[model samples]
Target: MEDRLLDKIAEPFNLQLPEYETLEAMIDGILPAVARFSEPNLLPEDSPLYVNSWVRMTDRPGATEVVMYRFQGYQQGEIRVVTDGEIGSKAYEVEESGDRIIVGESIMRDSFLYELSFIDDDFLILRRHGNLANIPHPYLFFCREAIGTRLTWNEALERLVDKYRNSQFPLLAVGLFVAAMIALLIYFR
Candidate 1:
């Protein structure tokens, strides 16, 4: 029965038992820290203590434009957002299975800190907290196709230098001409 329960929970996110266990343990560890903010009296209907935000990044090398949501509540509560790019949607359907969990999504597993949760409806909410005291806000980035394309550092530097050179030559020439005129005026005056 426990296995089945785990399977049912893991089916949507395509998470293995061990992975889910790790996540559960992590949540348990942080629960104590957020307990103070979870008080029913503290949360207001109109201005609930928790705030949700979204973030999408583009124009990075070897990365795709992604839309992610974040929720901030307690000072120590954590959330994670997982996407199809890193973990294919076939494994985890955000629309269908994401509503089952109560927390945020687990996007990437980098060294950077993240807030992870699985909503009841199966949509994952990944919250990233910038400041402890400040209410968390979502950051969304929509990049053009040009911004999505990857450019090597060398190529980018070369392009930048080319542009700088093209734009700077005219300004430099104008400056020199102005200086020459000033010199001539001084010589004659």
Candidate 2:
């Protein structure tokens, strides 16, 4: 079934999963990369939008593999994807040290550090800690957002920005705007 139908079945149950419990929970084949930070060379704060890509990741007894993938603009509407039958699964592990959690393949291949900036049931953001991925992104590891339905181009631009924004960024921006306006008024008086 497409995401929308699968989503409908799950949505009616109001099955909001439990709050993120631990590092291992993050890797148990639940959260897939729905969106990724845009690729233009720029800061996250300056990124225009995140890109949409449906990544199908599967897990077996002791391994996980990114089985299928597709990009948004490349194949719009419906699910036309490139399936990799030979991208064999790899052993995975999650290790915790104080507040830090490092997770990746068992041998640390294609590995990345847990993002410190944000985490929630709705999103999984990763950062390579200034390191680069095989297909490097501007933000190294970046933010992701997903939905059950296709999005318009404009909607695509906003989803990732909203998903990864600090709760305070928007509020602080408004505050700064008001402060700047007040200062200008006083100076003109």
Candidate 3:
């Protein structure tokens, strides 16, 4: 039953039992560290754009405290919030299951999958593995540089448009629009 449970947990992340075990060990060993999300351009093109955020993990006696600091925006003069919460593992082991770590808030619960894909002293990456994630790539790159950088709404929109510029969809749409305009002009002439 334990083995079956492990399999079910690892299925979504596409990790083997041994790999998950290794990941679990790695996460436990690297406690009490902060992982800030990387700058927008450095991440995958389709990755969600955050104003700036840092997740601090502190190992406790039986549970780990995960604190998140997200920069909402700079409009109202340094808008930010720090949410402190404990990491629960009763239903599934967060270190291996690659599940959403509910930090009490429903709004923030499904923001990121909260799985540690890679971790080290300098940097660590997590997979945004949740239903609400709308990224083309599921990886969330976090590093020390992502600490205090705040992104504006216009910047985020520009990044999204830039991501699709290399794709065929934008070009096709432009061509169709131009063709229709030419047809109308010729018929009127």
Pitting candidate 1 against candidate 2, the one with the higher TM-score is: 2
In model 2, which regions exceed 4 Å deviation?
1-88, 98-105, 108-114, 131-135, 138-157, 163-189
Per-residue lDDT, model 3, residue 183, is 83
Q: Backbone clashes in each candidate structure, one number apiece?
A: 34, 0, 0
* True-structure RMSD, every candidate: 23.2, 18.9, 19.3
- Give all candidates' CA lDDT scores: 0.33, 0.35, 0.36
Which of the predicted structures, 2 or 3, would earn the higher TM-score when compared with the native? 2
Best by lDDT: 3
The digit string of per-residue lDDT tens for model 1 on 1-189 reads 547744664353342222222322333333343333322231232222234333333234565445443334343234333343452211111222222212223323232332332211111223333563463332122112232134332332223233333342466675676578668768988
TM-score of 3: 0.23
Q: Which scores better on lDDT, 2 or 3?
A: 3
Worst 10 residues of 1 by lDDT: 89-98
lDDT of 2 by residue, 22-114 (tens): 333333223233233323221232222224434332212433433332222211122234344453232322233212234344335665554
Q: What lDDT is obtained when candidate 3 is compared to the true structure?
A: 0.36
Please state the error at residue 51 of candidate 3 in Å.
Answer: 21
> In model 2, which range of ten residues has the least summed lDDT?
70-79
